[model samples]
Target: MMRKLRNILLTLLLLAIVALTAGSFFLLNHALRPADNKGRDTEGSYAYMFQTYPFLRPWVDSLRRAGALCDTFITSADGTRLHALYARATRPTRRSAVIVHGYKDCAVRMLMIGYLYHHDLGFNILLPDLYGAGQSGGDYIRMGWLDRYDVIRWTCVADELFGPEATIAVHGISMGAATTMMVAGEKQRADVRCFVEDCGYTSVWDEFAKELRAQYGLPEMPLLYTTSMLCRARYGWDFLQASSLAQVAASELPIFFIHGEADDYVPTEMVHPLYEAKRRGGRELWIAPGSAHALSYHDHRAEYTARVRAFVRRYM
Candidate 1:
């Protein structure tokens, strides 16, 4: 009888371990992978996006009609073929800007900033689709971890298209913003000039931990640990190892940090610490009133554009 009891206990323990591992795998996969749209994989939920701002679609169409939008593509370090839409100005100067969009967002969705820089400000703009989003080739989103390297590659595209004399600057919003910070820390050329990051979280681990708790009502201990392990094994990058906070601290790049006061998605508290880390670089911070997440530009376009114009003009 005692032997039978011991055998049953061992079986149950094995089952429990299997359950835990399977649960963690499912959680991470669901979180990182984009949703299926018909047969195609979408960039993830933009449910709140269209309802929040419906004008984005027509605005993109308008830009296309005016001969400002041009298709561009590049091969990533990992051999992923990425896509972008280059915005040309009236004049053919080497001055250029690379505008990166947020999580699940394509370059066309960034028409607001693209128009401000390309058409209005006259900086030849190139907006690239981040890996696993839009036309870019990837199965899962790197959450700005591996993307930092991809943005650097986009700088190469800028050089080839706009030539070596091109004065280049990169600007990113949300996840793209996080990519900018990560790139600032990476080995890069001086010709790339400066960066503008808006509403980006400090690190992938921090963002995922918050979302895991808020959305799933779960803690970030064993589950996050397991997720990180799975990510490292499958994607060749660990979420915990991808820290913009650590990156920006060691970077010499001049950064323009912008955040919305009302942003609860990435949370308003994040940018404060991030700005503090890079303060010695003469980093500029803007906390827009009544703005949420990536809404700072939408809420304060004139002020936002002016700040961007001033920063790039002075730095770039």
Candidate 2:
């Protein structure tokens, strides 16, 4: 009787694992697939974004009118044609700023940052559409793992455009921020002096696990690990290995970390540990009060700009 009971328990355990694996696959492929962002296509999405900063469109218009805007393309190492928008600085400074946008975001959405860098900060700006997003060609969204390599390419592109003496600083929002951290870890060109990451999660696995728990009220254990395996098999990358904490801990680049205190999307708690993990000499962090995910600039532009400017002055 005891032997039969053990056999039944083993069968139930195997069935449970099978069910979790199937369910996790369905959830990840359907929910987190590299689909176009519905929010960006609608004017409602930009209403708050555009309206909050009235000068954003005018700055873009002025840049275009002045013939400073250059829409360019670069082919990735894998032959994917990547798109980026470059704007020359008014003051002819060799300093370059490469802006990386978040998931499902295009290069055009980064014009506000371009304006800040080119017009106010006296630095040239390049905004790239990440692989598998916008005009860039790819089948999978790398969630900042592979995007880090693309950033290295962009750094080389910046050097090619502005010459080798150009100084570079990468600034990214959300997924872009995570990519910047990953890039900081990689041994790349010396032009990449510093990085600014706003509201970035710790890792692909951690973020997905948090999402699973929050959205579906599901435990991560078998489901998340199973999804990681699926991602490895299908996407050629594992979510578990794409860790920003490990990357940042391995780098010596100066990093300015910013996050909204009220940010539940990426969670404010994640940044503290990330900032604490800094092995580099230069690191700064700010938690904007009353702000939500990626909205620190929207809530407090002056403070954001000031802190960023100070960071640039000190590091970049």
**Candidate 1: stretches off by over 4 Å:** 1-12, 36-66
Q: Write the residue-wise lDDT of candidate 2 on 69-176 in tens digits.
A: 887898888888988888877877778899988876767666667766887789988888888766677765788998899888988888888777898999999888
Q: Please report the TM-score between candidate 2 and the true structure.
A: 0.91
Give the runs in model 2 whose Cα sits over 4 Å from its true position. Answer: 1-18, 34-36, 39-52
Model 1 lDDT tens row, 1-316:
9999999999999997898799778877776775742112232322333345565556456766886668888888879899987866668877799888887677756767777787568888888888888778887778888888889888988888887778888999999999989989988776788899999999999998998999889998878888888889888888779998988887787899999999999999999899989954668888999898898988888899899999988876
Q: What's the lDDT for candidate 2?
A: 0.82
User: Between which residue pairs do clashes occur in model 1?
Assistant: none
